[model samples]
Target: MLAPVTDETLMRRIEQFIHAEARLQDEHAYEAWEQLWTDDAIYWVPANGADIDPKSQMSIIYDNRSRIGIRVKQLLTGKRYTQEPKSNIRHFVTNIEVTGREGDDISVGCNVMVYESSLRGETIWAARTDYTLRDEAGAFRMARKKVALVNNDRPLYTLSFLI
Candidate 1:
């Protein structure tokens, strides 16, 4: 059993994790980004609404660990038309809060605004992301991430990069 950690320490660690994940994506380090997840990880972006079940509804991205690897492979292949030239993206996570905890699992929610620039032009995506991170021997690994895009219900442009 581990001793209770200070709120400041815990928040700092979580902020580091979130910032690192964003950096990995912005730098196009797909392999390193994938390594941030556990084996049973789930990366989901719900369509229509955030609270809907992925299985019974459509999802923008509902990838398992294997599929995540595949997605990265496809992106890195340079065959993805939308990402041929790649997009200059910088997403910042704000208003992050440690919402709850259950044993070794911690739930976090934050607002994210992603600015992307590509051949097609620039686009802004705003969303509220809920993350469930599992404590693995003091290090944290992302177990699940649910992204609720503000414009999910409307048809949007292609997104080759992870949110």
Candidate 2:
């Protein structure tokens, strides 16, 4: 049987994972970001109060590797209109709580506040994120990332980057 993860170890690993992801995105390291996920990983930004089932409810963003690839392409390619003047985003993740864990997988929950600054202005957005991380060859890879934004139900503006 596998050994259980201590609270300290789990928290440290979770924070490290979150910070690494933030840094990767901020640096526009799409290849590194892609490697953070499992083969069948799912990235979801759900509408407020919406169900987790992607098929049933509309998600603000839902992506697998292919969709993630397209998004990366759009962001990197100068031909994409949104890339004309890229928006700068900083993600602040905190209040991390571990909900559960199974052999090679862990369930983590946290609060996120994202700040975006551009020539247009600055906007602050908040969300609650749940992550399912699985161990692969002793490294953690995200199996699922669910982000439920507080203002998801309201009308939104353009989102040029991953949240």
- Indicate which candidate wins on TM-score: 1
Scored by lDDT, model 1 comes in at 0.90
Question: Which 10 residues in a row give candidate 2 its minimum summed lDDT?
Answer: 1-10
Q: Mark the regions of model 1 whose C-alpha exceeds 4 Å error after superposition.
A: 1-6
Compared with the true structure, what per-residue lDDT tens digits does model 2 show for residues 1-163? 4344476876787789888988887776877888898878889998756465787877888999678777777776766555457667788989877778888888888898988887668888899889998978878899998888888889877777778
Q: Which tens-of-lDDT digit does each residue in 1-163 have in candidate 1?
A: 4344468988899999999998999988998998889899999998898788999899999999899989999988989998878899999899888888999999988899999999999999999999999999998899998889999999989978988
CA error at residue 88 for candidate 1, angstroms: 0.2
lDDT of each: 0.90, 0.80
* Clashing pairs in model 2, backbone N/Cα/C closer than 3 A: none
Residue 128 displacement (Å), model 1: 0.3
